[model samples]
Target: MSAPITVHRPSPTGGRRVTVNGAIVGLAHDDRDLAEFLRRAGLFDAETILDDPRWVEWRGGRAHHYEAA
Candidate 1:
């Protein structure tokens, strides 16, 4: 199984950081950018990514969540 993707929002700056299996992938400005990064990394597909509840959680400003995409 793939490692769960962890999304973190750091203090002050309010930037989004994405990490897979403990390795930092990239910092995203928004959900769309995060999805695009995941797609390029072969973690998730375009069809179900945006519509998934996990993505919705992040968009809602949840600090952290484990997404096993």
Candidate 2:
């Protein structure tokens, strides 16, 4: 409904924290991969996630996986 909010955590801590409306939604851990952080945060939307390797072959496939859960 609105633009995504990004909470940046930098320095010795070496990571970022992302939240929605002050809720502890996700941690952009420096040690961990960004993708994992996003997945854990449940940020990726099915409509936007694309399988670039085979997008044409997999039309709407991402929606199926995301919707299944």
Candidate 3:
């Protein structure tokens, strides 16, 4: 059986990646579905994201801002 997923924001600038069951899954720079997948899988960390400016995708691309809050 597949292990549970634990998502965390990417550490590098412009280098997006996701974690699932201790495994890494690369994410597209502007893939909205990828964002949803992370959220649904209980891997998203909002507080950690807003606390770090560099990891923010605000300026990456208009198509990448998947959050409205």
Candidate 4:
């Protein structure tokens, strides 16, 4: 099965669209923002799982990337 969290590609202005369980969470400009989004989603250990493939899927570019190329 796919991960529950999905960090989409960066937009033209910056920041990536974050989703939890296929629902829109918010826009994250950096890793800190991503953590906060996850925290709000009830994942208290958001920071530690950012790099864990079982928790998140970084699309388009890569993890922590918030700039469109």
The CA lDDT of each predicted structure is 0.57, 0.38, 0.45, 0.94
Off by over 4 Å in 1: 1-3, 44-69
TM-score of 3: 0.30
* Candidate 1 total steric clashes: 0
lDDT at position 22, candidate 3? 59
Better of 3 and 4 by lDDT: 4
- Which ten contiguous residues of candidate 3 have the minimum total lDDT? 60-69
Query: What TM-score fits each model?
Result: 0.57, 0.35, 0.30, 0.95
Q: Write the per-residue lDDT of candidate 2 for residues 1-69, one digit (tens) a residue.
A: 333433444424344454443455554443233345445656464224323332212222231122221
Q: Predictions ranked by TM-score, top down?
A: 4, 1, 2, 3
Predicted candidate 3 versus true structure: per-residue lDDT over 1-69, tens digit per residue:
432433244336553455545555555344554555555656476344432444433333342343322
Superposition error at 59 for model 4 (Å): 0.3
Instruction: Give the Cα error of residue 9 in candidate 1, in Å.
Output: 2.2
RMSD of each: 6.9, 12.9, 9.9, 0.8
Among all candidates shown, the one with the greatest TM-score:
4
Clashes of each: 0, 0, 1, 0
Ranking by lDDT: 4, 1, 3, 2
